[model samples]
Every structure is written in structure tokens, then in C-alpha cells.
Target chain A: MIFLSTLPGVRAVKNLRVLFMGEMQRLQRYHIIAASLVVAVIWIGVLHFTDVDDVTSIFPLLLFLDATSMSITLIGVSMFFEREEHTLKALFVSPITKGEYMISKIIGNIVSNLQTLVILYLYAWFFKEINLNIFLLVFYVIVISVFHSMIGFLLAYRSKSFTELLTGVLKYMFIFLIPVVLEQVGVITGDLLTNLMYALPTKAALLLLNSTTNGVETWEVLYGIAYLIGLSLLLSVVIRKGFEEFVAKESGI
Target chain B: MFKVENLHFTYPKNKEETIKGIDFEIREGEVFGLLGPSGVGKSTTQKILIKILQDFEGSITYKGKNLKDYGRDFYEEIGVGFEIPVHFSKLTAMENLQFFMKLYKNHEEPDELLKKLGLYEDRNKKVGEFSKGMKVRMNFVKALLNKPKMLFLDEPTAGLDPKNARIIKNLIREYRDQGGTVILTTHLMNDVEELCDRVAFMADGKIVEINSPKNLKLQHGDRKVEVEYEMGEKLESQMFSLDDLKEDEEFFRVVKNHRIITMHSKETTLDDIFIDITGGESSEES
Candidate 1:
């Protein structure tokens, strides 16, 4: 970790994380957090209407925190607010490098986004028979939320405004939100989709957490954890470097 | 305090050059004005000097050293007040000031500056609620918090009321009085004439006219006196060349006999001299 930070540009990554968290405190907003919690509670309540095993169905609510909440709601909305307010120019004049700024967003956003998952987990504790390990559940939520956030960050960075980023995310059913649907339906449970799911950082996190709680071997969970870290780190670097061409000189207002 | 020589800059996409070889020098404790119209590259010039926009083609030497030699540590030496308001609107005025103050080495009392700018009463209020004039005032306080030796002000008086403008200009003068140098950029003739010890008029990305405002006007001004007087209950006006009037008897007698209602010389304004020197209009577009 010291070696990574000592490298030419990675030192800024930590400060960027700190600043990003600060920005999230100001931008993620209290209303949105409250609203997301309400949605998750309502999602769990919907399980009471059906005769489904409520414990198994309630896990969908936790997965939704990573799958739907951070992707469309938190990271996507942050870009929208920044576009509306137009503080990006001010950021340019300061000594805070773009790399540092992005890292800050990642750290701040990833943590705050976990609030919904925490709320859902506690909500399930009081309402349903949640058989999952507490520590593994939180670690799963954090890692999975961060992965979805980066995907959202990449899209949000490309989007000019909140409306545009939102509409862009909404307009695509097959490309953007497919992963969310594929996880919920009982039909897409074939080997190809399962392999595809394993390749995804969020799915890998969710699968690893479920398997560990189900008394899976230590080696399998660590293997899933390794894959999750490798995928997210690789995508993060690629996104940061590729966006450099357009980050400073955004095309439209 | 600063020097820019033969600086050439063109934006990445544009074919036309924005800044064309501007040369100037600023000494300590003096207010140097970079007066020009919009798209004349005044801001670009400042950016290059302050190291905001790198990759320019020219030599910028500060305190006898290349600007490129210094790193982020150099930002501690100066305070830059952008022409537009640049504050974290979510925070209070003091919060914004305090955050930026930590980034610099030399710091000043934030509350004292707030009082100086008449912003102490509203120091804890959120910046988003501030009016345009109040925000500009807050912006000035942010710049001065570092006790910078060299200050860069671009359109510093924008959106400020006359009283607020006067306060800001006075603060600038006081900053100079304390041995600090300032680079003021504006199209406001009044600000240039009042605050600048020396003014440079830029055109076509190059400085076409440079001198003290008084000297520029004097050099291009008509050396004639326009006198208005009341004679036989009728007001009369006449212009006399200062050189010819000294030898003309009637001109001398008219001034010596009648009480002068108003007497003033015909002097060109800084703007007028600028148009004459640059051979075109010099309207500011900020």
C-alpha cells in the first residue's frame, strides 16, 4: 500500500478519496438517502403479500442496494448536481489534481452508498429470518456498492447533465440495467449467465458473501474476493485514464 | 514582482492566436493594470504567468527564475481572485475562507478580513444566499486571507456596488501600501484611472499602449484650455492653445479681467488614448 501511494500519481488517490467523501456529504443529500431507505423497506414489505420464503426473498433488497441504488441514484445524481451548479471550473484552478478528485469521489461515495444496505440489513433483522453472517454481509455490501459506483461514475462522467445522465441510464433497458434484472429472474440461471455473473465485480461480491455464510470453503470465498478486487481496480484505472481526454475539456455545457 | 516576455498562446482548437507576444514587467508595491477588450487574451496572459494554463509558447520569468522551475509550492506565494465568483456555496463564507487558507503557507485572520470587507456580520451565513455584490466581497476576502506578496485580480470589481467597489479598491491600495504588488485586469476606465499607477492597453493579444494614465493622456492630449465665462449676463466659451495663449494679449486679458466660472484643459481619457493608440475600439467583454 505504501509502495502504491509512493508511485508518481497514486498518492493523490487517497486525498481524492477524502475530498470525494467530503463532496458526498454535501451532494448525496439527506432526502435521497431517506428516500432510498424508504424504498428498501417497502421492497421488503412487498414480500409479505406473497407466500415466498420471506428470508430468501429479502436478500433481493440488499442486492438492490448495489445493483440499483448506487448505480442510478447516488453516483448518477452526483454528476447531475455538479452539472447544475458548475463547480468543475473552480476545481480546475485549485491544486487538487483530477486523479485526486476522482479518488475522493470513489471513497466518499462508496461508503455513504452503504447506508441503504445497512438500513435494509437492520430492517430485515427486525422483520425476517436473516441467516447471513454480519461481518461478511457488510463487506459484501461495501465492495459491491463500490463496483456499481464506478460503472455509474464512468457513465456520469460522460453525461453532460443530470437529466442527460439519468435519461441515458433510463433509456437503455438491455445494456445499463440488465445486470439488475438478470439477478432477480429465476430463468437466467444458466451456466453462461452464471459465468457472466461471476465476472462482474458486484455479483462476485454478492456470491462470495452468500457462499461464505452458507458454510462454503475458505478457498472459494478468497478466490471470489481476489477476482472482485482485480476487476474493480482494472476498470478504475482504465476509466480514469480514458476520461482524461474529455475530463478537463467537456464538450457541451 | 513578475515578468512576461514574448508570450504566444493559441487555444487548442482555434486557428487564431489568443495571446500574441505580450511583454511587461511589474515592480513591487505598484498596481499594474492590463486593460483590454474581450478575447484580447488578458486572462490567458495572467493564467500563463500564474501557471494555470501551461503549454504556452514563451518565456515567463518570475523573480529572475523560470516559472516552470517551481512546483505547487509556488501557489503559496500568491492570491488569485478570479473575475467570476468562485466559492463553495454550500458552506458559510468563513468556511470557504478557512478551507482555502489552509492550502497556503502564509495565512491571515479570516474574521479581520471579513470585518474589513464588511462581511463579518454575515460570516456564518451560507454563501449561496449572498447577493452578487456580497459574493464578490467575499471573494476578495478569500484572496487576501493568504497575505500574498503578489496578487492577481481579474475584473475584481465586477458585480460590486460602488461602495463595495471602493472598499475593494481601497483594500488593494492598502495591500500595495504594505509592499505588495498587484496585477489588475479590467475594461473599467474608472478603475484603471483611479487604482493603476501604470496602465497597459492590450489589443490583438499584444500590448499596444503602456504608460501611466496621466502620461498617456498628456502625451496624446490637446494642450488647449477650454474656458467658460459670463459676460454681459451671457455665457461665453472659447478654446486657447496653452502655447499660443501665453503670447496672446487678449487671451491673457480675458482670463485676468473676468472671474472664471469654470476653467479646465482639454485632456483625452485613458479609453480615448487607447482607441487612438490601438487604431480601433477597445470595449471590454468580461
Candidate 2:
């Protein structure tokens, strides 16, 4: 044990892997993965009745929703469940760091969300003959998933219960979806509004997802990638800080 | 093994300090129990020692190094069992234990612990399906999974039946006999009396009294003995000062000439001392 403690970097990586695997197992055991798949099938079923041309337009929106909005909502629900069970207190006493705990949640949510995105893409390909940049799609999915998972942590931290978290998620969606809806309908246009929209993580995610399906200008694609990455990093730091405070308060410390 | 001096803590929203300046020590291989009433900063003090609550105004040395100087490695040698069971309800008991066990370098077989706690039959069942007592037992298993050097338990057997509670208390004693230190916090006076080598009573965030159970009992008890004897067809009782019982003619007469039914020293109970020292706030029982 003394020798192992001396090798902290190795121990940290090992603990992180264990934590991540545990989170993934919890996601599966709770039927969250099956629920995500069911949601994908439902969306694809709904689109199957629409015209093929309409499918092309709706496909990016569905993928973006799964990557960002749905990921955040699912992560929030998972966090509240853990809090209700008082498992967070158990985690705090383990050898793993708080940063590892936060990252494992982010990584776990991304993996689960990515699985849903793949199913959606397969459905789109079978019916609509969709062809796109798979690498970029996956990259944006990870970035957007981490970004939204951080938001989910913040929501869960402030909420007193799962019911309160639901209300907070609704409020968050209403505010964040406005810019995305305006951009999608061409109601907000030009470099100024688009540049301003980049400030919102949801809008930035939508821009990146659109770049994968529909053609995007090189500069816009670069800007979307940089904006989401930078915002996700900032949110990660803020969420870690807030998480420590929330845990201290919730644990009655 | 641990030395805490002048410890003080104030919650951010509170107007006054919750843990007023206090000092105590936990010797190695001994069960040191912290007893106090509700909201008297017992849990807060435990949290600080466990490193869950930082930014405190004091110094705590664990194994000769300052506690603050330790990092995540500090938890590697310590195990904490909370008052309430903390487990993933959706997962099976074994799964929960396995997941936690992997976080530490040292590992103990969960099956052995579950069997000892009578939980092996239901090890494959989800924790959410377990009874409250069963969940509490699982919490004990979780705490011991790492083969911890020092164990911190809060109400370790609050909801167990006599048999189960005895099993846990015996395990605690065995742990101590094997050179492992323990910090126990509970409202169960029986546990303190049976397990603790020394106890500290806290009232209003200060150590009002600290001593061994036997020592405290002796200190608080009246120096008298109660003697009951059968005299011809009647049972009578007499009280005698214990200090001069050897020279008391009445006590000798009753013991020599009459049928002595019962003779007992009136030792003060830990419960009595606790209530008296903590201002008679009834200990909360679950």
C-alpha cells in the first residue's frame, strides 16, 4: 500500500477507470441506456413517416438534441438519484479525487449519448441515405456532451430534489433552446447574431452538428469547435468548484 | 495515533462557531468513542477529522503528520461508516461492495464479511430490496472492504437486533485487539460501555468529561453497597458505605447469620453519567 501511494499518478488513473466503469454499470442497471435507445427509436419512427427531404433537415436537429439537451437531462436525473441515495457521501471518502468523480460522470454520459447517436445515424443512413463526416460528428458529440453534463451538475447541485431538478431543467431548456430555434428557422442571421449565438453552448453545439451533415464554411466550423471546447473547459472548472461546495453543504460538514 | 488541539469550526451561515475550541487524543489500538446530543457538533468534528470538512482553525496530527498535509492518500488507510447506510440502491450488494473495494489498494473479500453478517444469502439482491437492518449491515461490510488501519463508525449498530449488534461489537473489539484504532460516535450507551477504552462527552461543542467507562462510573457512583438478605420468612435490604464494609458488624452479621440474597455495589451507569453531563437531554435511539 505504501508503494502504491507513492505512485499516485498510476493509482489515480486506476481509480478513475474503476469509477468510470462503476458509473457505466449504474447507467445500464438503471435502464438509462435502454431508455436512451428507446428515445432514439421513437425519434426515428416519427421521422420515418415524413418525406425523405424533410428527414435530411430534421436529422441534424435530432442528433444535436440527443448530444446536448438529452445528455444534460439524463445526467441531471442520474445525479439526483445518487444524491437521494446518499452515494455521493460514500464517494467522497474513497481515494478518488473530486475531479475524477466529475470527469467520470462526464465521460459516462458521453459514452451513453454516443451510443444513442450511433443508432440514430444508422437509422438515418438506412432510410435517408445520409452521408457525413463521422469523425467530426463524434468529436462534436463528446464536446457537447461534456459541456451539457457540466450544466447538469450545476442544476443538480442547486436543486433540493428530483422534482426541483425537473423544473430547473425545463427552465434551462426554455432559455437555451430559444437561440437554437431562432437560428434553425433563419429568424436570426448574419455574422453578429451567429457570433453572439456561439456564446451559448447549445447554439455552438448545433452549429457543429450542422457542419457534419450540411456543408459549413471553414471559418464557421473552426469557430464552433473552438467556442464549444473553450466553454466546456470553463464550465468544467466552475462545476468542480461548485461541486465541492455543494458536497460540503449536503454532507452536513 | 491522533492528536487534535484547539479545534474550532463555524458554518458559513451560522452566527457562532459550531465546534468551539476543543482538544482530544485517540490512542492507537483503542476504541475512542465520542458521545454527545443532537446538533452538538459530534458529526461536524468527525467530518473534519475525516477531511470531508476543511478550512478549520486547528491542527490535527494523524500518525505523526499534519492531517492537512495528506491528500487523497489519507483515505487509503481509514474507513468511514456513516450513521445512515450509503450504498447504490439500484445495484446488488456485491456489486456495490466490489465497486468501492476497487478504489483502495488494500482489499478484503466481501463474501467473507457478508457471510459473517448473515447477508450472504441476499448478496445478489439489490440493496434497495434489503431491510433497514440489512442495509446497515452492508454499510459495515463496505467500511471494512479496504482492510482499513483506522475505522470511524457512526451508530454502527443502531438498528440491529441483539444477536447482530453483538456480532458487530465483537468485530470492533477484535479489530482493536489486532492493533487497529477506532473512532466511534454513537448514542448507544451500551456500545460505549462495552467497546470504548475511553470516552469523551461533548455538550455545547466542548468536552465536558473524558474518562474510561469504569473510571467514570466509579467517579460518579456513590461509595455504598446494597445488601439484601432473607430473615426468617421476610426479605430485607440494607445500605452500607462500601469504604468501611469490611469492618461493619451489621454487614458481617447479615452475611454470617442470615441468608444473603444479593449484594451489589451501587455503580453509576454510563447512561446516568451521560445524561447528567450533557444536561439530561435524552439520547436519541433509532
lDDT of 1 by residue, B1-286 (tens): 7777888988778898888888888888899998776767776777677676667887888888899897655666777776657776777888777666644445899989999999999999988899989988876787677777888887789888888899999999989899999998877888889889998887889999789988988899999999888787888888888879779787778888877799889988877876787665666544
Q: Pick the candidate with the highest TM-score.
A: 2
Local error of candidate 2 at residue A93 (angstroms): 0.7
Q: What TM-score would every model get versus the actual structure?
A: 0.83, 0.95
Clashing pairs in 1: A16-A100, A16-A103, A16-A104, A17-A103, A17-A104, A20-A104, A20-A105, A21-A108
DockQ of 1: 0.23
Query: Model 2 over residues A1-253: C-alpha lDDT tens digits?
Result: 6776569787778877999999989988888878888888888886787766446667778887777777778788788878888889888988889888888888888888888878877877776667678788898888888888888888989899888898988887778876787789888889887777767768777888888878777787788788878887898888878888888866631
What tens digits encode model 1's per-residue C-alpha lDDT throughout A205-237? 555656634665677578667876777788789
lDDT of 1 at A194: 62
lDDT of each: 0.70, 0.86
Model 2 docking category: medium
